[model samples]
Target: MAIRDDYIKWVILITILYRVGTTNSVCELSVSHGDKLYNFSLASPTWKYPHGVLSEDGFYKIARNGTVLWFQLCDGLIFNHDPPRCFDCQDCGGPSHCGMGCSALVANPLGGYYVCTTIGRSSSTKVNLIDEKNPSMGVVVKISSSGVLTNCSLSVSVFCDSNGLQGPNLLETVGTCDYATVLRHPSGCAKTVSLHGNGLGWFSTLLIIVLCFFVAYLLAGTAYRYFSLGIRGVHAIPHLEVWLSLPHRIQGLFRSLIRRFRRPTQGHRSTYSPVNF
Candidate 1:
């Protein structure tokens, strides 16, 4: 009994291994920026969450859990936190048209923000000018599935007045992503009803074989009679045996019919009569 149990356990272990090795998720992502494009990422955070656990990997990896934001500089530096060059445009695209302010646009890799620049001139003797760069864009996030992983991507675009004053907007766009942990049941593993196995099962199997033999026997008798009618080549031994095994009633009727055919007809000439010279 112990040995039998061990064998069953071994089989189950093999099945589990096969299943796990084949199980994994696929993720993909793409981000569209102003003229240029950049790959978005989910990186570790310096500030801890409500429970002291730093939100790493991404903001919306699981949804409704963390924040998602991404920012890039003109020189090509990407950040998640407020950077020195970024300034807020609270009123420019916010509930209040405050026109200008500062806020957290990219909160990862240190607090960074996007900056929109404006040119100003002095009214003094010589033309003097002051220039300022402010956060002119916001982060757009996208996530999708890849093999065994879910990849999160981000991009930055120029904000128009039509664009809202939000810091991070989860733009749901049709894009590909490579993300991990998006596990799913593998194909061809789901349950389905199949006709191949639906034979009345073993009981039906036995019935089918018996029925086939019965049908073959019935056909063999009919074939024999047709063959014996001078059809020449059909009077084989196998056909004779099949015909002889028919039920008494059928056999009697068949023999009677055969006798009528064998009887001489009026057109027949007697072999014993001598031919006229």
Candidate 2:
């Protein structure tokens, strides 16, 4: 038999005003932030939930159970958590929200809650190549923080999906960091989130289907009765009493009809009349 296309539905993908580090949660606080191996991830808080991953290989949606559901492979990141600096963007336009290139938004490498300026971008092609061949087994993009981000030389912290929070990449400020401090998504990370099923919607569709079948059966039965037995035939049916009575209405009706058609009569005249005797 030809294999039917198996469908597993899930919701994934979102464009960003920031990097994958852009988030508001505690756990995903990367002990930094994996893989030309094409690993996918989101910020820490998302680890307990389902999430999406974009790679040169393809877009894969991880189930809440961490099952890798296949998606299509094409150019570019599906969810660019990294938004480009408005003016600093090169091919920047409506399509360049994550910046004109692949940008990395690292968490405060210097420590404390501050959006990292270590964030930068490089050509997509180059970045993909870096992701493939880098010693860290991750991509290496250009540093375009323009000093908003510190140029780090230390191993930056990173996270993974299959694995929990960990540090693989490095960040060295050369002793500088973005002085601006604000509550920002912790970074030097990637994540895999489990996407849950649309239980409610799926059940609702199933319920509707079952109800439809029941209604169809009722209609079919009614139609058959109408075509086979006309209105007069319906009148010949037993009354409600037949359904709920000691003596059925059908039995009484038959008895009454028989009595109405039959009358008492002499079978034969007497052989001798009184006059003849």
Candidate 3:
């Protein structure tokens, strides 16, 4: 009996945790700033330039002075050519020379190419990606600084354009280290549901939890009856009589409540009754 109770408790706890995790997972795809909520789930997938100038492959690329930079939105960069060893990008790079969201190939004065990655492992699903405050711009998703060099960062300013998939266009290059880009995508727009608004209400959430517990209870009770008490068929259901009469019991309870709160009847009295005396 103790073992069965423990099993039921574990099942109930797991079910509650699963439900809560599912609810929180939805919130992870969005960001809240001030009074607005920006849901970027639509643009969560990896986005790359359709055409490449230097190479036939697709990825955003730009050349400045003698340095060439390559990057992708919402994901890491994939290299089509062999890249040099980068000691700083151990966890963020692969054998194919692909690295996190952005990479740079710089020409050395001594005549060899030096390859390094700037932004490391940025994804839309990651929470707190919009930590940068840009009051003029509605939403900004900035990647955490993890570069081969010090103080290197990437900032993407997202603008609302319901019909635009316009850009990850390079806006500015800050001192050959930091890069800023603008992405005009539909996901930059505010969602109808805000961070603290119009999701499943508390009452509905409670109802779901109660229903789950009730179902679990019934299953556990039924199993116990069948296996431990040698009961079979419909008789295996625990508290079978109580459940069957629950509707009537509920109705009776409501009726009693109504009567308790009902107004009392008032008897009619004639004002002329004193004339007979």
Query: Which portions of model 3 show Cα errors greater than 4 Å?
Result: 1-38, 42-58, 79-96, 100-115, 123-138, 147-149, 194-277
> Considering lDDT, where higher is better, how would the candidates rank from best to worst?
3, 2, 1
TM-score between model 2 and native: 0.22
How many clashes in each candidate?
Answer: 45, 39, 0
Residue 143 lDDT, candidate 3, scale 0-100: 51
Clash count in backbone of candidate 1: 45
lDDT of 3 by residue, 176-238 (tens): 566666667655554534556667989999999999999999999999999999999998999
Q: Among all windows of ten consecutive residues in candidate 3, which has the lowest summed lDDT?
A: 49-58
Q: RMSD (Cα, Å) of candidate 2? A: 23.3
Q: In candidate 2, where is summed lDDT lowest over 10 consecutive residues?
A: 66-75
Scored by lDDT, model 2 comes in at: 0.32
- Tens-place lDDT per residue, model 1, 1-277, is 9999999999999965653332211111123333333322112111222211112221212221232222221111212443233344232223232111211122212254444221100110010001112212222222211123323333323222222122223333223421111111111011123335445788788999999997887567556755664444445335555556667769789999988877665336554578798
TM-score of 3: 0.41
- Candidates 1 and 3 compared: the better one by TM-score is 3
User: Which number leads on TM-score?
Assistant: 3
Best prediction by lDDT: 3
